[model samples]
Target chain A: MNMVVCIKQVPDSAQIRVHPVTNTIMRQGVPTIINPYDLHALEAAMALRDRLGGTVTVLTMGPPMAATALRKALGHGADRGILLSDRFFAGADTLATSYALTSAIQKIGESRPVDIVFTGKQTIDGDTAQVGPGIARRMGLNQLTYVSAIPTIDQEAGEITVHRRAEGGVQVLKTKLPCLITMLEATNVLRRGSLPDMLRAERAEVETWNAEAAGVEDIGKCGMKGSPTKVSKVFAPSPRAEKAKMVEGDTAEAKARVAIDALAETDPQLLSVIARQPALAS
Target chain B: KSKELPEHLKAYKNVWVFVELEHGRVHPVSWELLTEGRKLAAALNVDLAGVVLGPSGEGTDSAVAEAFHYGADRVYLVEDPLLENYRTDPFTKAMTDLVNTHKPEVLLLGASTLGRDLAGAVATTLATGLTADCTELAIDPNRNMAATRPTFGGSLLCTIMTQQARPQMATVRPRVMAMGEPDRSRSGEVVRERLDMVEEDIVTKVLDFIPDADSNQAQLAFADIVVAGGLGLQKPENIKLVKDLAAVLGAEYGCSRPLIQKGWMTADRQIGQTGKTIRPRLYIAAGISGAIQHRVGSEGADQILAINIDPNAPIFDFAHHGIVGDALEILPALTEAFRQRLAVDRLAG
Candidate 1:
């Protein structure tokens, strides 16, 4: 059971701040890390590999610096790392990104068969949970998204059962092998790399594949040209003209009282609604 | 180079909304899309239709009728038992088949779990582009559908267009669009379609469904009053303050995305673009800096009270009422004040 986990190196969004005047992202000095959600995906793959006698291959498509992310996945017990970086892949949207990554996965499959392909539910930057489905569709694999748990995997039977998170409940789904799975966040805690794993990861020779090596058959579909959806414009959200009505008080308690008073005065119905609650009446 | 819509693809017309139905009830987002779809259809000078796919029963029939009541000029029905529980394989096949046969130019769906899951598969099968979680939808000058959504974690908005794809697809999250009134007297044409797939061919099988227990779940989307905490609370124990305030106000409590990621709050209690799109009358946000994702979900509230130690927290920009103090301290104070006020009012009564 060989698994391939896709990860992305993204700017830490928490530290990212928009400039006050320019309203542009201040990228200076901000550190980059493997997407938090993808860490969970990587961890899931590693856990499966540990349970079953198999190898987990980590894959990423980005700039040369993206190799760092792959190495980090190696540190977390991935068997191998592959970085598909090319100038042609720049400015690719979800569709184009999936195409490039899927092509690389195909190229990887030429050498070794892939039983399962794993991806994060979504990237923090993209937040569009489309890539996993796109890759699955392109490769003709069944997609199990928002998957919270992989309860069992029958390699001999070529089947896997997973608990998928849906709108109002959990759907326990059984799907065939050779499927694509997008892991939901907080499903499992990520494991830290031990000293030997860290050392091996630091010295690991990360495989670098260009567009041609990645077996991208169509150059047109590799980047912006292949992307059907185009971003026409990007702009910051306009601020509201009226700032928050500042409730002034010398102390936190005083401020809380004043805020509550102001809220009650503005919306008296709130109090009446509270009074109607049977639990509150007691 | 600008490519024109090929002659073969130019035949695609009409704007269709996927009327989502589950457990014999229609999700309100379907009506919301119909309302917005009506505007887009009118803009494109095309017919507005609703596509309802479900098991053959009263649920499917009512969904088709309700589609007509909610401004759909026609309804496309694909009734099959395979679509009863919304396994991706059958729903995707049914939807893609309908699109390929009917050739609607614009397809809309709610960004709910089912819609997102189905839309991706359909769009990919059709080899078309799809924009998810769109906040705005309109027809561009080129007559193509322009879908605008938050990008880069909601720091910026980007308008995306399917340059050369037929049946331009987009999914708008629930509550983003305003729901229109249903004209019960209105009726639409019902075009029933047959899905050829059987249960065995579908790769995935639903073993069981564990319905979310109402006792522990947060109904933040429909709550009248909501008190939410963010990472600013600093500790998991501080969540009690937000809950206390919500208890006194007889409201529901939720948290920001970070809290959920940190495992401090459950996924259902998360209020954001990805979680629940809430339209509460009064929303109290504590220790939240109002990131774009969290802001989009809570901005629909009639009144927002934000408390953060950082005076320059982004939450203040849109929040109606703000307190520049530590939420850890302020939340307890607010809970105490609300408790006292409620107790006094009870005694007076």
Candidate 2:
């Protein structure tokens, strides 16, 4: 039961600061971390490997510096690490991103067929949740997204049952192996790597693959050229001219009443909604 | 199919908003889009059109009439019972067919669960660019659709443009746009279009429409005053602090999307990108880190007072007021303060 988890290096959103002059995010000094959601997916993969007695390979696509993120993955108990880095892969949108990743996964599969591939439901930056499905489509693998729990995996039988979060409720679905699973957050807690694991991760040699090396031939469809969507512009939300009408109430109680009155004046339904809740009011 | 400028659709000249209807009732986001569409139309100096696809019935006709009141200059009514329940395949076909026949410069759809799903498929089918979860939209001087949304989780904003694409498309989150004033006297021309597409060709089936539970309905989109919490609350149980404050102020309660991801609360109570957009009068953000994703969702609030231990938190950058304090201590203090003030006000009144 060999599992491969694909993770991304994302700027610590908490530490990101906007450049006041250029109106661009200041990315120079911000330290990158494994996308918070991908951590859960990595943990899920590692836990499965631990339980089923198999190898876990961590894969990432980014600049050369992204090796740091892969090392972090290795420190978390992955048996192997692979970095898919190339200038051609830069500025790739979800479509091209999935293409490059799927190509690398195929090259990896040449050595040992990957039983499962794991990714977060979406990246914090892209927030599209489309890459996982895109990869599944490109590789002809079963796509399971918004997965909350993996109940069982029958390796020989090539079957897996998972609890998938649908629009309104959970759908307990079953699918064959060799599938891509995007785990929802909080599905599993991440484990801290031991000192020995950190030492090994620090010393381990990570394999890097360029576009041609990863078996990608169509350079046009491999990066920005393959991406159909383009971002034209981004700007700050315009501020409204009118300031908030602060109530005249002096005390907290007075302010509360004023707030309630103001809210009721605007929409009485708000009061009804609150009154309906017993715990809300004394 | 991927080629440019179908001879038939060359003359369509305006922006259109697809008014999504469910259970014979129009979604409120449609009206909201009308207000937004009206602005873009004026900017482009073109007519704003509402394209409603459904069966020919009173509901459909009423929606057309309602569209005029909301500022649409004309309504394109596609009458077909097959369109009653939203199946992605049929809806996409119906919409694309209309676009191909009557070329609109821009298309706006609500970024609802259904809208996102349909927009992606339709944009791919048309091979046109589409932006999702747009918090703002404007027709540039060049007549391109400029869709603005937060990037990197709302730490910064980015505006996306679909260059050289006909029928430029964008999906806006619910409540991010204001609803237009209803004018009962206003009327618009309604052109009924024929839907030749059949239901059998559709691949997905509408198993059921599980309406939201009464208790679970936060109505955050319609909330006037929202008090939301975030991971800063430390413990999931501290969410009750926000609930208590909301209870006193007669406001709805919501949390940042991380709280939902953390399983601290259900999706209904979550507020942010991928959660809910709220335009409340007074928003009390307790312990919220104000990530760009969450900021985009709540930035529309009229008054935002951020309470967090870290004054330097991003929440304060946009917050109208800020208090560097522990939310746990501040929440109870604020709640008790509100309780007493409100009691005194009721007596005075």
Candidate 3:
């Protein structure tokens, strides 16, 4: 089996802070890590590779600095890492990003046929969840998103079965290979890299490919030029008058009671909830 | 400024919202988008329509009725058992075909698992732009639908527009927009179609569907009252206090995204930009700092009561009422008071 997992180094969104005065995001010192969801995707791919004799190739589309992320994935037992980064690829939207990624996936398939492609449900920074489907459309691949588990795969028959998270239930879906899977979060815990794998990954030569090298034929379709969605404005959500009338109570118990009273006073529905849920009132 | 459409896209006129239904129940998000779609249609001075694609049954019929009740001027219906479940192939083909036959200036879908799946596929197949998780929708000065959504992890908001695309696409979460009462007297035009594609042509097949009751799922997003804790709970076991309070009030319990990150709770219980965006009647938050990301997710709540050790925590700024105290001691006290105030029939696990 030949599988490719797409990963991106994103800012640790949880640690990102906002400036109190300017109300602008403080991305200056924000450290980047593999998108948390992508870690799940990588783990899924690695597990498949470990169970079925195969190799997993990790891929990314970022700046030259993204090579660091690729090296880290190698430490997790990926056989190869390809970095598709270029000045022309900057300011790309989901459409352009998918175009570049689709080209890169095709180029990677030149040597060996890639049966499956994996990506996180969405990137933390962008959070669009569109790139994977766009790649599938361009490459004519089966797109399985929000996939919780892959139970079975018939390589010879090009068939795969997966559990998909739907609106109100789990859909057991049977699709074909040459499919793209976007792994949902909390499906599996990521594994620790072995000492030998870590050592080999640290010194591994990361192959960095620019737009041309990555088989991007049209420069116009590579970046901002190809992006149809135009961002006209960027601003912060205006804050309300910042003040909280602190509930007066010396002890925790007094404060808790006073707070609940105030909430009921404001939204009587809070207490009416008990009457509504006959089970609670019973 | 007027939006100039090319010769190809000039035929695009009305605004359309996808009416998402499965298992005979329409997702509330679809109605919310329709309520929003009404505005965009009025602004564009065009018809507000809905596309109901599903198995031929009460699901599609009532969805069409509610679409009109929610102010749709017309509805395009595609009914087939093959379209019963949400598979990418049939849904995409049905949607793309509708757009090709009758051009629409704007198309909206909910940002649920099904919506995101079909929207991405349809937009790509039609070669259009799709903005995800939009917070606001309006007709801009240029006569295009300006879809404003969060970017860079919800720290900033950006407005995007598909300048040249025929049908500008966007997705919004369920509770982000307020839905008005439906008018049952309203009715409109219905265009019925069939699924041209065959089941054998579809590669992906649905084997079975295990309902939500089969899993230990947290119903946090739609709860009327929600009590949530943050890292301030300090220890894993302290989460019991949150559960206790939720049990007394018959409310759902959730946590800030970090608790999920720390494995203290399941991912479904996380309330944040990347998790579930909740719109409860009364949200009691304890030990949460209420960062912008968390704020974006929970701001939809009608009233928020934040309890934290720091009075300066940002949560209080937006939270209606607040108490500055340690959640460790406060959660137990609050749970006790609520337990006595509302005698509950069941105790939490």
Candidate 4:
């Protein structure tokens, strides 16, 4: 089985800072990490490869610096890393992104047909769980999104069963191979790299593919030209006239009393929830 | 604007909202999407239509009727046995084929799991633009639908517009939009369609559905009083303080996104842009740094009480009331005080 896992490099949110005056994200010096959700996908893929006897290839579409992300994956037992980087892929929205990724995956399959494709439920930067389904649609693969568990897979039979997270429950579904899965975050923990894999990550060369080399047949469909959605304006949410009033007290108990008193004046409904009494006093 | 489209694209005529019917019940977000669809359609002077697709008896008929009650001028119905369950292949094909047949100027769906799954597939199949998790939608002066959503990890909001795409597409955040009163007397025309695909062609099958136990699921989104702790609580064990306070007040307790990432809390208990958008009457946030992402989800609360060790924490900026103190200590103190106060109030009253 050949499994391809899609990952992205996103700014570490914990380290992200907002501008004091402008209230916009100050991203200049922030370091990037492989998207947290993607780690679950990578782990799921690697776990399957470990059990099912196959290779796990980590793939990413980003700038040249994105090779660092692939190396991170390689450090975590990935058999290979492929970077799809090109100026033509810049400013691509979900549609063009899926197309570009599908093109690269197809090219990868030229050597060995991919049995399963994996992606995180969504990227923190975009928070749009569209690209995975988009890729599945373009590649004619069955889409299993928000998958929590892959209980069974029969490689020769080309059959698989998964537990998918729906709105209110888990849908235990059976599907065929050559499918795309968007792994839900927190379903599995990423493994720490072994010493051998960690050393290999430093020495291994990541294969970087440009648009043409990645078999992008149409240049127009790779970037902004292919993306119909355009960002018209970016702005900060307007703040209220006054900031939160500092409720102060000499002690924590006083502070709680003051805050509670203030909340009573502002939202009596909430106050009643806590202290509402029956008509027993009457 | 519809007139300017080339001959092939000119048929796109009305605004369509996908009514999410699953397991014989309608998601609250479906009604919310229709609420916004009405406004968008009125702004563009187009009909507000609902696309309700499911099995014949499993809430499909009721969904069609409710669509009109929720302000849909017409309802497009597609009932098939294969549609009883939401399989990506059949749902996407049916939705895409319908969109191609009856061109809609703007299409909206809830950003729920099912809606996102189907919308992404259909939008890609149709080769159109789709803005996900939109918090705002409006009509541009050029008559295109302008969709606004949080971007750059929720620090900034961006307005997206589909240029030259016949049917502008967007998925709205579930609780952001206000749902209006439904008029029971409302009636509308129903357009019927069929899912031509068959089970034999489908690659996936639903073997069974296991519902999450209600006792385990957190009802944080609709909680009237919510108390959530953040990283300032130091570690997972300290979460007990938050629970103690919530227990006293009989409130649902949640945590920030980082806790979920850290495995300290379940995903359902997270309050942030990526998690549930809570509309509680009063929300008490403890030790939270108040990232813009967290702010987006909690800002809708009628009143916010923030407690943090750092006076400059951004949570204080938007919170209605602030206490610059350690939540670890303050939470326990607040709990004790509130307990005594309630007891005293009850005895006096």
Candidates in order have lDDT scores of 0.88, 0.76, 0.88, 0.89
C-alpha RMSD values across all candidates: 3.2, 6.0, 3.4, 3.4
TM-score of chain A of 4: 0.89
Off by over 4 Å in 3: A14-27, A268-270, A278-282, B1-3, B213-217, B261-264, B332-349
lDDT of 4 by residue, B1-349 (tens): 3324466766788999999999999988888889889998989898999999899993888898999999999998889999988899888888988898899989999988899999999999999999999989999877888899987667778788896787899998778887878999999999998889889989899999998877558888867788999999998999999999988777889999888878898888999887889988889999999988899998989899999988898988889999999898889988888888788766876
Clashing residue pairs in candidate 1 (N, C-alpha, C atoms within 3 angstroms):
none
lDDT score at residue B259, model 3, on the 0-100 scale: 94
**Candidate 1 Cα errors over 4 Å, as ranges:** A14-28, A249-282, B214-216, B231-240, B257-264, B308-312, B324-349
Ranking by TM-score: 3, 4, 1, 2
Q: Cα deviation in Å at residue B124, candidate 4?
A: 0.5
| Residue-level lDDT for A196 in candidate 4 | 99
TM per candidate comes to 0.91, 0.74, 0.93, 0.92
Better of 1 and 2 by DockQ: 1
lDDT of 3 by residue, B68-185 (tens): 9988999999989998888998999999999999999899999999999999999888888999999999998777889999877777787888988879999999899877689999
The sequence of per-residue lDDT tens digits that candidate 4 reaches over residues A76-111 is 999999999999999899999999999999999999
Clashes of each: 0, 16, 0, 0
- The model with the greater TM-score, 2 or 4, is 4
Residue B17, model 1: Cα distance from true site in angstroms: 1.3
lDDT of 3 by residue, A180-222 (tens): 9999988999999999999999999988899889888888887
